[model samples]
Target: MTLSVLVTRATFADIAQRLHDHFDVDDNPDDALWDPDELKRRLQGKQGVMSHGSDRIDAALLDACPTLKAVCNVGVGYNNVDVEACTARGVLVTNTPDVLTETTADFGFALMMATARRIGESERFVRQGDWTKTGIFDMFAGSDVHGATLGILGMGRIGRAIARRGSLGFGMRVIYHNRSRLTAEAEAESGARYVDKSTLLREADHLVLVLPYSASSHHAIGAEELKRMKPTATLTNIARGGIVDDAALASALRAGTIAAAGLDVFEGEPRVHPALLGLSNVVLTPHIGSASIQTRRAMASLTVDNLIAALGAGPQAGQPPTPVNPEVLAARLR
Candidate 1:
C-alpha cells in the first residue's frame, strides 16, 4: 500500500509531481491557511507532512494522527515544531539548512543597507511627490554602510555570511555576540570579533539580529535593550519574528532611540503592528529572506527527499538525508 502524504502549503508544481510519483499526495493548490482544527482534520490519514513555519505541530496534533511518521520542514529553522514532543512519539523531523545560506544572507545585507541609507523612506517620498529642490542637500541624508560598525547577534551560518559581506565587501568593522564564542579560526574566516551583548548593542552602527526564536529568546530585543543602542544606529532583523519585541521597537523608532529599522519578520506575522505601519523610518518586507527561485526550489526538493526517505519510498529509504532527531532512527534500526 502506498503511504499517504500531505503538503501543508502551496508548493512548486514539479515538487508536487515528485511526491505524487511516490505517494498518495494531498496538496493545497489554493493555499488556504488552515487553523489547528482544520489542519488536524486534513492530517487524519496522512503518514507524512511537509510543514511550514506557520503550522503548529504539537503533541496534541501528534496524538490525533497516530499514522504520522515524518515531518519535513522547508526552512532552516524548526522552532515551530515541537521536536521534544515529536521525539517522544518517535516521529522524525527534518529541515533544509545549507541550500538557503547565501541567498538569505544576501537579502539580510540588502535590508540593512536599505535601512541605513533611508532607501525605503526616500522611495516613499518620491512616490508621494514630496521631492522638491529646496531640501536637496539634506532631505534624506542617512548613515553609511561602508566603514560602519556591523554587529550581529547570532554568529551562525547565516550570520557569518552577513559578516563576510560587511567586512570584505564593504570594509565594515564586524563584531558579533553569540551564546557561545566561535573558535579563533572561524573568527578569522568570518572577519568577526567576539564581543559581549552590551558592547554589541552600544557599538554597532548597524545592528542586525540573526538569532533563532525560543522561549528564552522571546523578545530578546525589548525596551531596555533598545535603550542601550546608539540614537543614530539602525536595527535590522532577518531572523524570525518574536526575536525582537515589535512594540518596543516601534516606540524606539518613534522616540529616535534608533535612527531606523528594517524588519523582514514580525511578531504576529502577516498582521503587523499598527504603530510599525505608520512609521516612516521603518522598512518592512514580507518574510522572503530565502526567496530566490533557485533556492526555494532546492528547499522544496530537499523536503520531498526527506519525506520519501523517511517513509521508505525512494532511493534513500530508511536513511533520510537530514533528521533533526536521528536518535529516533537509530533506535528503530537497533
Candidate 2:
C-alpha cells in the first residue's frame, strides 16, 4: 500500500514531484496559511508531512492525526514541532540541518553589517530624498564592524561560522558564551574565547544571538540585560523569536541603550512590534536567515529525503538522514 503525505506549504515543483513518485502526495499549491483546525483537517489520513517552520505540531495535533508516522521539517530549527509528543506517539521527527548552516551564517553577518553601518536607515534616507549634503563628517555615521569585539551568545555550528568570519575575515575579537565551552582545538579553529554571559553582554561591541528558543531563553535579553550593554554596542539576532524581549529592545533603541539592532526573528513573528517598525535604528528582516535559493532547495530536498525514508520508500529505505528521534527508527526495527 502506498503511504500518504501532506506538504504543508508550497515548495519547489521538483520537490513535490519527488514525493509524488514515492507516495500519495497532497500539496498546498496556493501557499495558504492554515490555522490549527484547518491544518488538522488537511493532515487527516496522511502518514507523513513535509512541514514548514510556521506550522505547529503538538500533542493535540498528534492525537488528532493518528496516521502520521513522519514529520520532516523544512528548516534546521525544530522548535515549531513538539518532538516529545511526536516521539511518544511513535512519529518520526526530522529537520534539515548543516545544509543551510553556512547560508544562514552568511545572512546573519550581512544583517550585522547592515545594522552596524546603518545601511537600512541610509537607504531609506536616500529614497526619501534626504541626501542634500555630501561627506558631512557625522551624517549617518555608524559603528565599525572590523576589529570590533564580536560577541556570540550561542556557539553552535552557525555561531562558530560567524566567529570564523569575524576573526579571520574581519580581524574582530571573537568572544562567545554557550551551554558548554568548545574544546581547545575548536576554540583555536574559530579564534573565540569563552566568557561568562554577563561579560559577553558588557564587553561586546557587536553582539549576535544564535541561541535556540525555549522557556529559559525566552526574553533572554530584556530591559535589565539591555541596560548592561554598552551604549554604543549593536545587537543582532538571527536566532529564533522570543529569544529577546522585543518591547524592551524597542525601548532601548528609543533611549539609546545600545547603538542599534538588527533582528531577523521576533517575539510574535509575521506581526512585528509596532514600535520596532517605527524605529530607524533597528534593521528588521522577515525570518529569512537560510533563504538563499540554493540553500532552500537543499532544505526541501532533505525534508523529502527524510519523509520518503521514514515511510519505508526511497533510496535509504529505513534510515532518515537527520532524525530528531532515532528511537522511533529503532522501534520500527523491533
Candidate 3:
C-alpha cells in the first residue's frame, strides 16, 4: 500500500507535484483554514502531514490520529506544534531552518526603518493631498536610522543577520539580549554586544524582537516593559504574534510611550486590535517575514526533503534533515 500524506496549506505548484509523485498526497489547493475538528477529520488515515505556522498540532490531535508518524513544518518556528506530545507518542517532528534566515532578517530591518522614518505615514500624507500644502522643512520629519542604537531581543540566526546589516551597512551600534550569550567569534562577526534585558530597553534607539513564542515568552513585552523603553525609541516585531501584548502595544502607541512601532505579526491575526487600526504611528503588515520567492521555495523544498526522509523513503530515508525530536527515532531503533 502507498504511504499517505496531507498538505495542510496551498504551496508552490512545483512542490505540490513533487509530493504527488512520492506519496498518496492530499493537497488543500483552496487554502481554506480549518478548525481543529475539521483538521483532525482530514488527518485521519494520513501517515504524515506538511504543516505551516498557523496549524496547531497538539496532544489531542495526535491522540486522534494514531497512524501519524511524521510532521514536517515549512517554517523555522515550531511553536504551533507540541513537540513533547509528538515525542511521547513516537511521532517524528521536523522544521525548515537556515533557509529563511537572511530573507526574514531583511524584512525585519526594513520594517524598523519604515517605522523610524514614518515612511508609511508619509506615503499616506502624499496620497491624501496634504503634501501640496506643506513646506519641505518640518514636513513629515522623522527619526534617523543611521548611527542609532539597534537592540535585538533574540540573538539567533535571523537576529545575527539583522545585527550585521545594522553594524556593517548602516554604522549602527548593535546590542542584544538572548537567553544565553553567543560565542566571542559569533558576536565579533555580527558586531553585537551582549547586554542585560533592562539595559537593552533603556539604551536602544530602535528595538527589534526576534524571539520564539512559548508559554513563558507570551506577553514578554507588556505594559511594564513598554514603559521601560525610551519615549523616542521605535519598536519592531518580526517574530511570532502573542509574544507582545497587542492591547498594551496599542495603548502605548496612542500615548506615545514609544515614538512608533512596526508589527508584521499580531495576536489573533487576520483580526487585529481595533485600536491599532486608527493609530498613525504604527506600520503594520501581514506576516511576510520570509515571503521572498527564493527563500520560500527553499523552505518548501527542505520541508519536502524532511517529509520524504521521515517516512522512510527518498535518498536520505530514515535521516530526516532537521528533527525536533530525534529521541523518538532513537527510541524506535532501541
TM per model? 0.99, 0.99, 0.98
Question: How high is the CA lDDT of each candidate model?
Answer: 0.95, 0.94, 0.94
lDDT tens digits by residue: candidate 3, 1-334: 9999999998898977877888999889899998889889999999999998888999999999999999999999999899999999999999988999999999999999999999999999879988666456877678888999999999999999999999999999999999999999999999999999999999999999999999988998999999999999999999989989999999999999999999999998877999999999999999999999999999999999999989998898889999999998898779
Ranking of candidates on TM-score, top first: 2, 1, 3
By summed lDDT, the worst window of 10 consecutive residues in model 2 runs over 14-23
Q: What does the lDDT read for residue 102 in candidate 1?
A: 99
Model 2 C-alpha lDDT per residue in residues 3-98, reported as the tens digit of each score: 899999999998779899988888899999888999999999999999987899999999999999999999888899999999999999999989
Candidate 2 vs. true structure, TM-score: 0.99
- Per-candidate count of clashing residue pairs (backbone under 3 Å): 0, 0, 0
> How well does model 2 score by local distance difference test?
0.94
Per-residue lDDT of 141 in model 3: 76
Model 2 regions lying over 4 Å from their true place: none
